[model samples]
Target: MSSSSTFPRARKPKLGYDTDQVEEFLRVARRAFDGTPAPGDPEVSAEKIRLTAFGMQKGGYSTAHVDAALERLEDAFAARERQIAARLHGDEAWLREARTTAQVVSNRLARADGERFERVNPLVLGYSVKEVDRFAERLSRYFSDGWPIGIDDVRTVTFRAQRGGYRESQVDLVLDAVVDVMLAVR
Candidate 1:
């Protein structure tokens, strides 16, 4: 069970999330996570959580703080789901899926850095090409040599936004897939 205490209380001003609403939502989410259904519980899927919106209140929860907490919750749920899938399907099946997914990611990474992802207009901001490429190299190594990397490592990867860099969404989606593969195999 996640304690409400772990969530920072919102301020009194209207700039933050509504304190009561966020707390109540978290409580229900935590219950749902514990396998006890709560009334009006949102689907705890990673995409749903990532796209969740909270009502703002004068002194409500800090947006950044709540967002960070939600990200952690999404990761936990994803990891648990992967664990259940692996247990049900067996290691061989999970490994095969992981390898296949890794190969897809590796193939994308094999392209030249400038061509690896869809590019935005030169004036638009996107992920740094060099940074993403370097990380892609590490991912390639992981797939080829069975490197000691973890799902969290992939989940936490960040790149600087730059002009004419790879599409941020593309890289993020691939990283999400990588995390899924790592979790499934673990």
Candidate 2:
């Protein structure tokens, strides 16, 4: 069993990631990171870490701490992935792939606001086009003008949901690609 202090508990009456789930996931992550994954274990990757979510429960692990730890774990995995790719494919090939991914992301981000992503019907709830466009502008600046943007900024960004807005899945897929580009070059 993992120690209770592995992560601080959420304040009473507040909910956080379920402690058992978080601990079990961490144990699996540890095994994956150490290159000793057991049979039947789901493959773990940087992308998997980035996408991981846990159910909430009262007195569970603090969400903030768990999120930060996951971010670091993702970074470590990404770094290892980069190193292995460079070793196997040569540094230039690794860089070329990163550049290609960046170009694709940049081209998508370069589209005009409200046109960058597919829109949901007025009756359907989706991300606000204006808000998503605002963030897309920032991403464009990051790629075109070398504007400063942290990975966390991309990771934590949220847009207001509204009727007749950009499709949430499309926006999420683009954001995931952006994170991939960021990770590739880091």
lDDT of each: 0.76, 0.91
- Candidate 1 local Cα displacement, residue 113, angstroms: 2.2
The runs of at least 3 residues in candidate 1 whose Cα sits more than 4 Å from the true structure, single-residue gaps closed, are 1-4, 8-25, 46-72, 86-91
- RMSD of candidate 1 to the true fold? 3.9
Model 2's alpha-carbon lDDT is 0.91
**Would you estimate the TM-scores of all the predictions?**
0.72, 0.95
- After superposition on all C-alphas, the RMSD of every candidate to the true structure, in Å, is 3.9, 1.2
Candidate with the greatest lDDT versus the true structure: 2
Per-model clash counts, in order, read 9, 0
Find the candidate with the highest TM-score and give its number.
Answer: 2
- Model 2, C-alpha of 56: deviation from truth (Å): 1.3
